[model samples]
Target: MKRRTTERKMTDKERKFLVELLACTPSKFKRWMEGAQNALVLWAASMLGMVLGWLILAWLIHLLVNLEVGMRSPYALGVVSLLAPVCGLYAICSSVQWVRNWPDPSEALRQDISGGKVLDETYNVIEAKRFKEPEHGGLIYFLRMDDDRVLVIYDHESIALEMEGENALSSSFEPRRELHIVRAPSTEYILEQEFSGEKLELSAPVDLTVPPDQWPEQESWCEIPWLELERRLGMPGF
Candidate 1:
C-alpha cells in the first residue's frame, strides 16, 4: 500500500491576503448562480418568446390584410414563419449571454436582484457549502492580491463524477474567506489577472480536513467542486 508523504502550508501574509480577497466579490456571480438554479425561469422565457413571436407574426398578417389582404399568398407567411424561430432563439441567447459576460457585478444585480449588497464580508471556508454539484458549470471569483488587477483562475477541464456524467469543470476552488471591496465610483480601474502557474492564487492553501467534511465527496480524488456547493448553501452576505 502507498502512504501519504507531505502536507502543504501557507505563510502568515498569504493567510491575511485571503482574508481581504473574499471581501470584494462581485454579486454578479451570485446572480449567475441563482439563474442557473431557477432554470425554470429561463425555460419559461424561451417559451414566452416563441408565443410572443407567433403573436407578432399574426399581427403582421392582420396589418397586411388591410394593405394586400385580398391578394395574399402563402410565400409571405412562410417566410415570416421561418424567421420567427430564429428571432426566438436570438431573444433567448441575448437574454442569457450576460450571465456570462456580466460587465459589472453591480449592474447585473440592479436589474435582476434587489436589496443585495455588491460586496459583503465573510470569514469561513466551511461556509462555502452551496456549490457542490456535477451539472453546474464554472463561474467567477473575486480573489484579492497586492496588485491592482484581481486574479482569474480558469478551470476549463472536464470531470467524470460518480453519480452524474461528464462535467466540463473540475477543481477544488473555494475562495478563501478574505476580501476587500471597492465602491461603484471606484470600480473604473478594477482589473483581473489569470493564473497560469501550478496552484491558484489562494490567500492560503485549503485545509485538508474541511473539504472532505463540508464538501460533497465523489469517488474521484482529483476534482473539487467548490462553487456549485457554495451557491447552494445560499452563502449569506458573508
Candidate 2:
C-alpha cells in the first residue's frame, strides 16, 4: 500500500470566503441539484420512449394492414411511428411527475420533518431510539413547533428545520450550555423554548458525538440575535 500524503489546508481568506458562501440560503444550491437530476431522468425516459414507440407503431400498422403478404403501409406507418415516440415521451414525463407527487409512507415523517408541502407539523413521538445502523445514529428529537415548523433535533450541536419544497435548513449552534434561538428560520438554529399551546418540552439535553448523514457539516456556527432570543424565552422586553 502507498503511504498517504498530507493534504493542503485552506488559507484564512479561502476559509472566510467559504463561510460567506455557506451563509447564502440553499435555494440556488438545491435548484442546481434538481436540474441535474431532471436532465438524467429525462434522458432515461427518452430511451424508454424509443422502445415503447417502436412497439406502438408496429402494432398500429399490424392492425391497419394485418401484415398481409407483400403488403406494407410505409406512408401511414411513417406518420404513426413519428407520433408514437412523442406520445410515449409525454406519457413517461407525466407518470414521473405523478409518482413524485405521490405520498410515500416511509417518507412521511421525513417529509413532515423536512417541511414539505403536506408537512405534518403534528406527530406523536412513536419511538425515539439511538441506533448505529444509519452510520452511528445520533440523538434525534421530533418536535412540532408553534409556528408549524417540524424540527428534528439531531443533537445538541446541530438541528434540522424542515422547510417547504423537500428542503431543510440544517444549522449548527454555538456549543455552549446557554440556550439560544431565533424567532424564525435562519442560517444558524439555536435551541430555545418557543411559546406553545401543546407545551412541548425536551426530556433533557441530548448530546451526540457524531453528526447525522443529512446534516451539513460546517466549520462555522452562527449565534442568534440576542434580543430575539430573549423575546422567545419570555424575558423582559427591552
Off by over 4 Å in 2: 1-37, 53-65, 68-140, 144-150, 155-238
TM-score against native, each model: 0.22, 0.29
Residues 81-199 of candidate 2: C-alpha lDDT, one tens digit per residue: 66556656665665567556543333322332233121111223222211111233223443332233233444432222322222121333212212223211222222123222233
In candidate 1, what are the lDDT values of residues 1-238, reduced to their tens digit?
1111222243344334333443455566676675564454655566566656666766687797744321154555665566556655665575577566555534432322222222221221222122222233332333333322233332333222322455333444434433322211222212221222233333322212233344432211213333432343234321
| Candidate models: Cα lDDT each | 0.37, 0.36
**Distance (Å) between predicted and true CA of 113, model 1?**
29
Question: After best superposition, candidate 2 residue 222: deviation in angstroms?
Answer: 22
Among the numbered candidates, top TM-score falls to: 2
Alpha-carbon shift of residue 28 in model 2 (angstroms):
5.8
